[model samples]
Target: MSSAHYDCTLSLTDFCSKETERVCKLICLITSTGTEMLSPTGFVVLSVALGFIMTFGFVNNFVVLLLFCKFKTLRTPVNMLLLNISISDMLVCVFGTTLSFASSIKGRWLLGRIGCSWYGFVNSCFGIVSLISLVILSYDRYSTLTVCNNNRWPDYRKPLVAVCCSWVYSLIWTVPPLLGWSSYDLEGAGTSCSVSWKVRTAQSHAYIICLFIFCLVHYAASDICM
Candidate 1:
């Protein structure tokens, strides 16, 4: 390329990059400074409710996990499904709910853009994982009850594989927002961040519709399997 052409191209590229950065900063400012949606008493109530969910979820899931670890007899494939569910739920309680709870208590997002994104991603992924786990467990039980011979015990590897697939499936929905198909932003509550379902843009709409369809199809398939 000619020297003048090369210089012009580099300058254009640099300008675009700076403009993108500026827009991103503006967006972060608006989202992180979302107006509070709760009164003092309401905020207190929300905090208490969030605390309950986190504490109860953690305790129950941790106990189940501990039992599975402590008892060999409880480590069967069916119980393994429970263990997977517990682990996912525990993650939601910690990585997902706790961040939202903290943000809600503070009346705004203290963690900035990265925190909101991470919070949304972890919450979405783990929530989907837990749902898939439940479906798998239900299917396992249904198969046990409906199978003809019912003598062959399911192997542990099968459940492990199912769990792995569940995580991957969850990622298919959660990761796209991070990649710019849509985005995570503070919800109406002003503290919790999640998929920007309210955005009216084409990409945001498409992502929401696709995610809804995926969930519906998977639920139907799980039901049929069960």
Candidate 2:
């Protein structure tokens, strides 16, 4: 069997920093809130899992970011869009997955309902940003070959415009989840949470379908790129 990347024995909650240890003695350090729903064993398991995922994920995104930054040859508009995607993915690894996991322990959200909304909102935003960034990237490449193309993105301005649009699109995808159109469930262990897949209003299904179609298009586009 493969060894886990983290010392799951310690867990993210029990792992200390001077910050939280100061305010709430019962709470562990470096967490978003004071919720402890996981058994030591459950937390160990989760921490081990998240640690491994983030370890691999963070490294790859960081490497991708470095490659984009370091290689002057890769400084195209598409690469710029991809760099935004990589950074968003990195933020999800760094903030979304980890903080949500830490705060979900003990079942109830310790971050209050507003915090919960923001958490879901931010995670969804990053997710959509990653997808939209890729979509924009594909278009940037395809535009170069189109016969009617009057101007191709030749500077930071165009890439910046694309990046802004990516964020706008991502915000559209994310805001509904926060408005209670999508649900958040404290899955089994308190320290874990997800958008409630079981419950759905009309918009929820539409959102899911929209995401599915977007994903399928990207998958096809990526295959073509390959």
Model 2 poorest ten-residue lDDT run: 26-35
Residues 107-169, candidate 2: write the lDDT tens digits. 344676656666666677888788777766776777666746556545678889989987887
Predictions in order: lDDT: 0.80, 0.66
Residue ranges of candidate 2 with Cα displaced over 4 Å = 1-43, 66-71, 101-112, 143-157, 187-190, 200-226
- What residue runs in model 1 are displaced by over 4 Å at the alpha carbon? 1-36, 150-154
Best by TM-score: 1
Per-residue accuracy of model 1 over 27-110 as CA lDDT, tens digit each? 445444444366777878888899899999999999998888888889888887788889999999989889878977886667
Best by lDDT: 1
RMSD of 2: 12.1
TM-score of each: 0.80, 0.61
